[model samples]
Target: MVNRVATYPYTTSMIAENMRLQVKYSEINTQISSGLKSQNYKGISSDTQYLLSVESAVDRLEAYNTNTNIVLANVNTMYEALGQIEDMANSMLTAVTAALGGGQVPTAVTANQASNALDETQSVLNMKIGNRYVFAGTNIDTPPVDLTDPAWVPQTSPSVVNSSYYQGNSTITSVQSSESHVINYGVLASDPAFEQLFRAYNLVLNNSGSITELTEASGLIRSAIDGIANVRSNLSINAKSMEDQIYQNEQDKVYLKELTSNIKETDIPSASVQITEIQTQMEAAYSSSVRILNLNLHDYL
Candidate 1:
C-alpha cells in the first residue's frame, strides 16, 4: 500500500489565513469609520500609561482654566462696583465743596443728593453675584452692609464712627491661578474710606441747616474722596494682576491641549492610506482563499 500524505494541513492553513484576513478587514473598517486607531486604552496598550498621563494633565489644565474664568468674572464685577463707588464719592465731594464754597446752607436739594448717594452706596455694598455678596469676604451668604433697621444710627458721633458696619469678617478671598500661585482679591464694605463716606453723607443729610456742620461735612467728604482714590489705585493693581494671570492660564491651556492632541488624536491622512492598503490586501486574500478552496488534484493533472 502506498502511503498518502494528509491534505487536512493545507486546508486548515488556508482556512486560518482567511480568518485572519477577515479579522484584519474588520479592524481596518472600524478605524476608517471611527477615525481612531483604538477606541479604548486597551487597544493601544503599549502607550496606555503615557496617554493617560497626558489626558490627566489636560484635565488639570482645563480645571485651572475654569477656575481662572470664574475668578476673572468675580474680579470684573468687583472692579465695576469699586469704580461706581469712586465716581459717586467724587460727585458727592464736588457737590459738598461747591455748596460750602458758595456759603450756602444745607439746601433740600443737597440733602436729597446726599441721601441718594448714601442709599446708592449702601446698595452697592450689599450687591450680590448669584446670591453671594462679593464684598462679604468669607461670609458670602450675608450682605456686607446692613442699614435697613430704624435703630441703625447714621451719625458722626464717636459711638457711630467707631461702630462696625460690615457684617463680614476681615478675611480676604483668594483664587488659585496656577498650580503654585494664588491671588487674593477681596475688599470689605467696612473699609475706612466707605465708613467716612457714609458718615459724611449721613451728617450732611441730617444737619439742622448749620453752615459749620456743612463745612465740617465738606472736609470729611474730601478726606473720603481721597481715601477712595487710594482704594481705586489698589483695585487697579489687583485687576492688572488678574488680567496677567488669565493670560498665563490661557496660554498654558492651549499648550496642554496641543500636547494631548499629539498623544491621542489620530492622523486622518495616514489612517486613510492604511485603509486603502488593507482593502486591497483583503480582496487579494479573498481571491486566493477561494482558489485554494476550489483546488482539485484532477484539475491539476
Candidate 2:
C-alpha cells in the first residue's frame, strides 16, 4: 500500500511564490511604463540631494543668461550710438582743420554742420529703448540730454568733464553675467567724451569769428575722438566676454540635464526584459500548482 502524501502544503507554498512573482512583475511593468526609476525623490533616495543641487545650478544659470542677454543688447545699442557720435566728431575735426589751413572760416557752413551734429548728438544721448533712456544712468524714464534747457552751458575749462546738459546721475549700468562676474556696460550722456564733443560744437557755433577759439576747439574735438574710441574698444571686449559666459552657461546646463537624467530615468529595455522573465516564471509556477493539486495517492500507487 502507498502512504498518503498531503498536497495542501505544496499547493499553499506555490500560491505564496506566485503572489511574490506577481508583485515583482507589477513593479517591473510600472518601471517600464513610467520610464523613471522612481516617481518621487524618495525613490532615488541617495542621489536626490545632488540632483536638487544640480537643478538649482541650472536655474541660476538660466537667470544669468536672461539678464546677460538684456545687458548685451543695451551695450550694443550704446556702442552703435557711440560710433555715430565718433564719426560726427571726426567730420567736425576735418572741417575745422580745412578752415584753419585756408585761413578763411566758412562761418555759415561751420555753424550749420555744428547745429546738425548737436541736434543728432542730443537725440542719440536721449535715445530710448523700450521707454528707458539708455544714457540716463539709473533714471530710466528721463531723457539724459536736454540742450533746450536754458540752464545748460558748454564747459569753458577746455578739459574733459561731465556735461551740464545731462539730466541723469552718475550711476553705471551693470549685470551679473555669472556667479563670479558682474559686467558694467553703462555709457552715460554725461561722459567726458560727450562733454568735449558738445563743447567743440558750441565753440564752433558761438565763436567761429575767432581763429584762436577755433584752434582750441579743434584740439578738444581730437581728444573727444580718442576718448570715444577707447569706450568702443572696451564695449567690444565686454561683449565678447559676455558671449563666452553665455556659451559656457549653456554647456553647463546641458551637462546638468544629462546628470539628472541618469539619476532619475529608468532603463526601459532592461526593465522590459525583467518583466518578461517574471511573467514566464509566474506561468511556470501556475502550471506546477495545477499539476501538484491534481496529484492523488491512487495515481502515485
Candidate 3:
C-alpha cells in the first residue's frame, strides 16, 4: 500500500519558491554584468521621475555642447582667414612703401602682385565652412565679396556712402553657447577695414603704372594695414571668449554626466554581493527540493 503523507503541497510550494529564487538570481547576474540598474524606463521604477529628468537635462546639455563645438570650429576658421588676410595686407603695404621710398614707378610686376592679393582677399572673404560663408554675416548662403564679376561696382566710396562689394547683409551671426549665453563671433566682409583693403588693392591693380596713383595707393594701403590690425585684435578677444565658454560647457557636462550616472548606473559591488547571495539561496532550494521529492516510505523503513 502507498503511504498517504501529504507531501504534494510541500512539493508544490518548494517548486514555486525555487522558480522565484532562480529568476531573482538571473536578474541580479544580468544587472552585475551590464552595470546598469535598468535597461529601460519601465524597469527603473524607483526614482524614475528623477532619473528621467536628469537624462533629459544631459541630452540638452549634449546638444548645446555640440552646437558650441561647431561654432568654435567656424570661429577658428574665421580667425585663420583673417590672419592670412592681415599678412597679405602687410606685405602689400611694405611693397608700396618700398616703391614710394625708392621713387620707382609701379610696374607690371607690382600690378600682378596687387591683383593676386586682391583675388586672395576676395577668396578669403567668401570663404565657407561647410555650406555657409563665415564672413557673410546673416547671408551665409551668399559669397560676401564678388570681385570676379565685371558688372559689380564698388557701392561704397571713400566716404562710406553705401554698401561695398560684399553682397551679404549687415546683420551679425550669433550662436548659442549655453543655456544662458550666446556668442556673437561673426565678422562681415563689408567691415570698413576690409572695404578699405579691397579698395586700395583694386586701385593698385588698376593704376600701378603711374607714380602719383602708386603714391596714393601706398597711403591707402598703410591705412588699411592699421585698420586690419585693429580688427584682428578684436577677433582675438572674441576667440578667447569662445574658448572660455567651451571650457565652462565641458565642466558643466562633466557634472551633469556624474549626476546622471549616480541616478541610472548600478553599484557593481552591491550588485555582485546580491547576485552571490541569490545564487546560494537558489542552489540550497534546489538541493532541498530534490531530497524532499526523493523521500518515500522505503527510506523511512
Candidate 4:
C-alpha cells in the first residue's frame, strides 16, 4: 500500500492575498444586500470608514427632508384656515353694510345670526390643525377666544367695556416649507385685526336703535369691517404664495428622493443578476483553490 500527501503549489502569501480579497468582496456584498453602508469606526478598518460616513450623511439629509415635508403640510393646513377666515370676514363686511343702512336693523339681527357669527368667529379663533392652533399663539391647546359666554365680549379682555383692553399683541410666526424658504403667515389672536373687529361686533349687536347711534356706531363698524376685509386680502395672498411654494417644494423633493434612492434603495433585478454571477465565480475560485493546494509529483510515475 502507498500513502500520498497533498502539496500546495500556491505560496502562503498568495493564499493570504486571495482570502483577503474574497473577504473584502463579501463585506461589500453584505452592505449591498442590507441597503446600509454605516461604518463601525471602532470595529471596521479605516478603508471602510469613509463609506460609513457617507451613508450616515445620506440618512441625515433624508431625515431633514422628511421633517421639512411635515412643516410644509402644517403650513398648508394653516393657509386653508386663513382662506376660510378671509371668507368669514367678507361675509361679516356684507352684514356690516346692511346694518349701516338700517336696511337691516340690529334688532332684526336674529339671535341665530348673532350667535352664529360669534360661534363662527370662535371656530376661526380656535381652529386646530396638526395639533396647533391656526390663530392661537404659542399656547395652542388653550383656545384663543371664548365667545361661549353670553357676557363674553368679542375682543376686549375681561370686558369689552374696558378701553385699555382694545389693543392686543401683533406678532407673526412662520412655518418652514421644503422649498428652502419659509412661509411667514401666522396671525396671532392678539392681532389688531381681530381685536378691533371684536369691538365692532359688540357695538353692532348692542347699539340701540337711535339715529345718532346708527350714524356714529355705523361709521366705526364700517371702518372696522373694511379692516377685516383688508386682512382677509392679505391672507388670500399668503395662501396663494404658500400653494406656489408647496408645488415647488414637491418638485424639489421628487428630485432629492431620486438622488437618495439611487444611493440607498436597491435594484432587485440587477442585484439578483450580480448575485448569480458572484456565486458562479465563487464556485470556480473554490475549485481552483482546491486544485492548487493538492499537487503530487508521484502522478508523473
- The most accurate candidate by lDDT is 2
TM-score, every prediction = 0.77, 0.86, 0.74, 0.58
Expressed as tens digits, the lDDT of each residue in 135-161 for candidate 1 is 888899988887654555756433256
Q: Write one digit per residue (lDDT tens) for candidate 2, span 130-247.
A: 7899998989989999886676654343434546688998999888988998888888888888888888888777776567767888988998899999999989999998999999
Tell me the lDDT of model 1 at 296.
69
Q: Which residue pairs in candidate 2 have backbone atoms (N, alpha carbon, C) closer than 3 angstroms, thus clashing? A: none
Query: Whole-model lDDT, candidate 1?
Result: 0.75
Summarize candidate 3's per-residue lDDT along 235-268 as a digit string, tens digits. Answer: 7777777778878877877887887787678889
- Residue 237, candidate 4: C-alpha displacement in angstroms: 4.9
Error of 4 at 16 (Å): 3.8
Task: Give the winner by TM-score.
Answer: 2
lDDT of 3: 0.77
TM-score of predicted structure 2: 0.86
Angstrom error at residue 243, model 1: 4.3
Where does candidate 3 stray beyond 4 Å? 1-26, 107-113, 148-162, 202-216, 275-301
CA lDDT of every candidate: 0.75, 0.84, 0.77, 0.56
Residue pairs that clash (backbone atoms under 3 angstroms), model 1: none
Model 1, runs deviating above 4 Å: 1-11, 107-112, 148-163, 205-216, 240-244, 279-301
